[model samples]
Target: MNFGFLKIAAAIPEIEVADCRHNTAEMEKLLREACQRGVSVIAFPELSVTGYTCGDLFGQPVLLAEAEKTFGELMERTADCPAVAVAGLPVAVDGRLYNAAAVFCRGKLLGIVPKTYLPNYNEYYEVRWFASGDELKTDTVTLCGQTVPVSSKLLFRSGEVCLGIELCEDLWVPVPPSSLQAVHGANVLVNLSASNEMVGKHDYLRDLVRQQSARTVSAYLYASAGCGESTTDVVFAGNGLIAENGVLLEEAERFVPGSRLVCCDIDIERLAALRRKTNTFAYAGPSPAFRSVAFDLPAYGRSYPLLRHYNPTPFVPSDDDGKHRRCEEIFDIQCTGLARRIRHTGARTAVIGISGGLDSTLALLVAVRTFDLLGLPRKRILGVTMPGFGTTDRTYDNAMGLMRALGVEIRETDIRAACLQHFADIGLEADDRSVTYENAQARERTQILMDLANRSGGMVVGTGDLSELALGWATYNGDHMSMYGVNCSIPKTLVRHLVGWIAATHADEATRPWLLDIIDTPISPELLPADERGDIAQRTEDLVGPYELHDFFLYHFMRFGVPPDKLFFIARHAFGERYAPETIKKWLVVFLRRFFAQQFKRSAMPDGPKVGSVSLSPRGDWRMPSDASAALWIAQAEAIRTDEP
Candidate 1:
């Protein structure tokens, strides 16, 4: 029952203090607008009906009665649409007052989730007005002429997208019930918060939302109490955010006063697929306790455009200042990871094979950065260039230029003679430039670096990237082997941008120009011989698709666990004109075939830092069976393509 798409809306509706009628009207307006926008699930802030700051009026009999009357009318108003909405109101059950959120879908009251933690600290006395949900004795309750299930353990269902709800403080508790909800079956978490405004509070709130989404590997929708609420003692900032699998895609700045709704389609298929991939995540034994609440959401046709933000450089920050800050931070993660390894092992230096390619360039930069960080002289960092069969003048010049500019210890070793000797040593022909020839050169280069590291009393620094590992482009036990790979977790597309970022932000006027030229050079492993102009002859993209397309497919497919059909659906939308459908189809097949065939390389990969969510490190993020079949994926991809007329 995995639905292809989920339309979610984080609604910030207009409100008035203690004005239940005005609140109901505003809620209805937003609900209708959301329904028209094809939002299947809409969420409003906590205590939205009677206003969160009603104070002692929560116990007022007149106010309670009016709130119920307005809610009944609001339920009738939203009865026609398929979109289910959660509205906050003070509900009294068996003479006990509770700060609760009521859910309505398709004319029926689905369930009610009450606040579990009552605030009792300074400036906040929620204990005076509301009761915790743990105080509830039963699940069945009568609301607006029908019996609705009322409990904190409610999972409102719409096919494979199981949703769990919790009040604001409920999520903030040490042992949040939402944790159990996720362990059981809920894949989507909803939080209705009426948190008051305070300095340094938003940061905590943002982190809380991100961690919850990541912990569950689920989509999280947070609708905080926004504008129009009473600010008698505390103020509310209309903050709304929508996050999926830990990444914050959209967030509205607090204190903004408008009817704001951040709407995006959650890739339910992706979440479900990830759960399948992480087979051990089923810590909770299979149970039939989950109830499916049915609702018929509009299709919006097969292709619904994605409104979520797309990071062209997922590894590189979009903001200029932030990108520099991140470059500095990541430089630390790489150098720190390596420095600790070096210190623990008592290695005196770090040796890297610099090729002036993006991956090796980044590795060399990390080594220099690490030594600088450790107060070790640059000369302690050894850069060896073992040029072989496909040596290009551009790369050779760039490599020498960078080593000279950085003042690192440089060693020049020509691998042509050494590899040819090895070929002869192994009784192989040196003239043949096949996988053996290419890999022999790579292994020889690595051997040189490794011996150099040992001779220098240091460890070899690796430079193979995540994308290279995914495609198995690295020579197994050759370039793929390293003591600690600084670039292992970074992808190809991202590696290019990081080098560019360093050039723009850190490199000097002279050092920067050569770095830019190095980035502009074609991405080649340089296994094949050079052309007439002494340029690269073995371009990586010729065998694999463009790194950008593969990266896009990788994020949705591996990170979110989206299916091939939906993935192709998204690729069509994102890279429509840039790449023709036929071309995308061809590369997509290449990606699947290569990805499945090459997981063995990833299975035995060296130690590397994980920079992003989707990593292929067998010990870390991805742990797939090396022989897992790509037949299903390839078949689905084939179906997406219509044969030429």
Candidate 2:
């Protein structure tokens, strides 16, 4: 019941028709096993105690008696365990039977949620034996030995988790009960189902659960009856699923020999954050007042074994096929945006600075692709290489080679002399190397590009990536300012992959070696003087931090709006083996300070297409004050100092 995490389980227990005693025993066995695995909330299939295919046997007095006795015993079994369990059964009240899910915690019955919609067409006739929840005479019904609230408006709460119960057919309705429950403050929804196996039915069922969870922005747990039921009319293949916000976290294998139990850890904090960010989710309308049942469940502390998979590189997909599709889509967006700018502005040439780095290389590729799409001459693309004091032979030669191989109009300008002259004019010594010395070179190169674009009747394509913008790594009014920034929304880590994809798929044989070599080269701004060996002397990572860590921090903080404490916790789990906790904590502090202090830079950023969920474009996605204080974020991060490495 922690705010950040809730461990849930979906169980399918083997059952015999009209054999409530044996079914209850089997359910207790599975429940104990799941609880031992640290599952806090467990949901079983619909009519799991009496079987959904009991048919006319559902009305037999003996079967009804056995179900009531078994339900009481099941409630007692949960008394010794801290886990809350939801099991389906038939509840009789006022001369009519209702299909309901009995929810209990510890030794008390929480409530009974009656099935609102019953399927009565085509091999299904629940209306023949049971009644829908719409015709309730009273709000309370006798369950086990105590009277509990029985209505469609009952919500159960245990600590920070709020749960709403729905049956099988309820999810397939035009508007689901879970939707209203979510709007009324339910963060978790559990469904008890007995859907029969059929061709293509599983896909629709899966999509239904996913779409419902996504629409409500809640965590959904679904459990269905399995092979132990009477398969007289339809085969019951036990299927269990656990999903959070449209993403399937865990699902059990269908048509297995025995009862299946699948468990996952859902992030309740993320759900809450999403709801708070969405205006419609908060201001939809006034919902009906419902009964709230509070129960006690053991609290999971700050740390626990994670059942959900945390991708180390959330910005980059792991699958090759997904990566391919993503790369294609991103390229399409970049090229399309550049083409529109070109056509709208009536520019004939595209001038891009070629530094032989990943960002510049990607920018150049996009420029060439846009020209091709617009049916412009390749020679109309002006590729400029301004070799400065720190430019090494590896990068310089790669730049020249790529420009020649791409068959673009190439231009070269040496800015060392211009920067030296500027330093002399400013009364600064060349021997005294400092920030001024570095920035002078960057500004000189940008001046050359701007001038070249003006002389050639073209536009300057910016190469600084989203990571640089986020950390304020770019020189203001130097490389950071441009007419158009193609890589403005791409992070540094993903820029490498995009370049690799182009080299492997788009580059010719003559250009492939140069592209690969550029990728193999180290990332540097090349602002200072080169080493005696004519190699790159200043590494970006050594000065700031790892781009991987920075990208991870940026994604979770901005995309999910996760606070610093939870972000640090998740990062520790995602990169514990690769990076030390102290190292991560240190850079996390740097990231927070820089992100807050550099809003003014992002505020004036050039227009670029957003290709992913996270974008810091001021006019599009993120808007913040330039002078906002980082005191709260910094204080939260500083409090997390630990002795562990």
Clashes of each: 2, 0
lDDT tens digits, residue span 1-645, model 1: 113667798899879988999989988888998878878788899988888888888889999989989999998877887788888888888778888888887677877878888878877789998888779887767777777877776787766777888888877878676677787778878889888878998999899888888778788889988889887788888878888877786787777887778788777777777777778766855543544455555556544456655553455567888777877777778878888887888889888998989999999988887788788899988989878889898899999999889899899999888877888989897568678988988898888988888888989899999888878888988999999999988888878888888898778786787789889999998878999888898888987879988877777777767667666767766664687878878888888899999999889888878766678888878889999999999999888853421
TM-score list, all predictions: 0.85, 0.96
- TM-score, candidate 1, is 0.85
Query: How accurate locally is residue 611 in candidate 2, as Cα lDDT from 0 to 100?
Result: 84
| CA lDDT scores, all candidates in order | 0.82, 0.89
Q: Could you tell me the lDDT of residue 408 within candidate 2?
A: 95
Model 1: per-residue Cα lDDT at residue 281: 65
Scored against the true structure, residue 151 in model 1 reaches a CA lDDT of: 71
Clash number for model 2? Answer: 0
